[model samples]
Target: MTNTAPSLVLPEISSARLTGLLEFLQSAEQLKDTLRSGTTANGRPESTAEHSWRLALMVVLFEPELKDIDLLKLLKLALVHDLGEAISGDVPAPLQTPGDNRQERERRDFLTLCEPLPADIAEELLSLWDEYAAAVTAEARIAKAFDKLETMLQHVLMPRQEASFYAFNLGYGVDRTDCSPLTRQIRDKVDGLTRALMEDAGRESA
Candidate 1:
C-alpha cells in the first residue's frame, strides 16, 4: 500500500461523509500498485493507474478533434474504463480466452471497489463503467478506441519485446479502433510500428 496520501481538496461536509469519501479515494490508491501486462520503457511493469492516466490524457489531447462528443463524460469513461482492473488486475487482450468471464469478474470487482463511495456516486461511476464496457454510446466507443490505442502505443514504444508480443498487436483491438476516423489513423500508425518491431524481432532471432 502507498503510504503517502494525496492532498485532496474537498468541500465542507460532515466529518462522517468526508471520511467515507476519503476512505473510498484511499482504497482507489491501490491502483497505483496494481500491475498491468505492459511495461514501462525501463521494463518495469506498468500500473493500472498509469494506464488510466494516459488514457485520460489522450482524451484531453484530442479534445479539439472530439468536439462533437461530451469531452467531460468521455474523460470520465476513460478514467473508469479500467478501474475494475485495479481490483482484479488486468488481463492482456492476447491472453484473454473465450468464456473467461473477464468482464463479469471485473464488473463485480468494480462494484466492490466503489462500495465506499456514496450510493449515487457509486452508481454513476458504475453506469459509466458499464457504458464503456458495452461501448454502446458514442463517448463510450471512443473511450474504448483510446484505451486500445494507448495499450498498443505503449507496447510499440517500449523497448523491443518478444516477437510474439509484436505479433499479437497486429490484429489486436482493430474492431474497437475502426469505429472512428481519428482512432483508425492512430491505429494505422501504431500497426506500422508494431510490424516494424515484429520484423526486427524476427531478424534478431534469426
Candidate 2:
C-alpha cells in the first residue's frame, strides 16, 4: 500500500507588502545622491552611501579593539546611521550651529523613510536609529566612534585648502577623555593621521 503525505503550503506574501518594500528600496537609492563634506580621491564629493559603506567596513577592521560588543548589531547600526540623509540630505558638520535642530530633523526624516516598510521592519529600523543617536548601548557607542573615525580618516586622506583643513580639525578633534578604550584608540589613530597630513602640507607649502 502506498501512503499519501500532505504537502505543506506557505502563505503567499501580500502584494501591498511587496510594493511597499520595493518603494522603500527605491527611495534608499537616493542616498547615493546625498552629498557629504568629504571628497573622493579624484576630488568628487562623497555620498552618504559611500560613507555608510566604509563605516561598516571600519567596524569590522576595528573589531579586535572592540570588547563585549555585538559585531552584527554594530554593523547594522553603521549602515542605518545615515539613512536619514536619504530623506533630509547630508548636513555637513561645520554648517551646524549650537542651537541647530538637525538631530531632531533627521530623526523625523528617518521615521518617514521607514513608514513604507512593514510594521516590524519599520520598528526595528527606527529603534536602531534611535539607539545609535542616543549612544546608550556599547554597540551604539562603538558605531558612533567608527562614524567619527571614518570622517576624520577621509579628511586626512583627501586634499583640502587651509580653511577646509582648519574646519575639519575644529569639527572632528575627538576628545578621548570620556571615550571607551576602543574609541580612544581610534581617536588616537585619527590624531596621528591628521598630524602626518599637516606635516606633509607644511612641507609642500615650503
Candidate 3:
C-alpha cells in the first residue's frame, strides 16, 4: 500500500476567495434567459453580466440629466444591484416565473456567503440590494425604473420577432404610461438605442 496524506475538506468560500470574490461578478448573472436563444430584440438575450454593464452605461450617460441627485452613489448602488443573482440566478419578470421565491432565497444564500466577507462590504451590498428591491428612495426608484425599462427595450428592439420575452403582451412594448416620470425619461433616452439596434442589425447581429 502506498502511504499518502488525506485531502483536507475546506469550508465554504475561504478567506482567499472572499478577497477575490468580485471576480465572480462577471459570471452569468441573469436568469429568465435561455442557453442559446435570442432576445425579443433579435440581439442575444442579456445575461446578468450584460444587464449590469448596460445599467452602468446608462447611469454614466444619464448622470448629467440627473443634476439634483447624487448620481455617483446611485451608479455604485446600481452596479452591485444584481450580484445576489450569482447565488439565486435571475428571473425575467415577477409574473412569468412561479414559485421560485428568488429574492428571499437569494438573500438567504448571500447572507451565508457573507460570512467570509469584510463586515462593511457585506453590509453595504446587502443594503444596496434591499434598496433596489424597495424602490422607495429616489436613487433606488431611479435604478429600479431603468432596470425595468432595459428589460422592455429588448422587446421593441426586434420587429419581425414573435415576442416571447415574457408571458404578457405589455401592450406596445415601448409603453411606460404607468411608470414614474423618471423612468419615462430613462425610456426616452434608451428608446433610440433600441431603434439603432433594429436599424443596424436589420434581421440578425450580435
Task: For each of the candidates, give the backbone clash count.
Answer: 0, 0, 3
Query: Which candidate has the top score in lDDT?
Result: 1
lDDT of 2 by residue, 40-157 (tens): 8778999999999999998888788777889999999999999989989988777888768888999998988888899988988899999998988888877877788788777776
Worst 10 residues of 2 by lDDT: 170-179
Note the residue pairs that clash in candidate 2.
Answer: none
Estimate candidate 3's alpha-carbon lDDT, on a 0 to 1 scale: 0.60
The residue ranges of model 3 lying beyond 4 angstroms of the native Cα positions read: 1-43, 94-100, 163-179, 185-206
Model 2 lDDT vs. the true structure?
A: 0.81
Candidate 2 lDDT score at position 13 = 86
- Model 1 TM-score is 0.91
Candidate 2 at 77: error in angstroms?
0.8
The better-scoring model by lDDT among 1 and 2 is 1
lDDT of 3 by residue, 36-112 (tens): 12254445555665666677787888777776777876887677777666666666553435666777886776566
Q: In candidate 1, what are the lDDT values of residues 74-131, reduced to their tens digit?
A: 9899888877877898887767999999999999999998888887788899999989
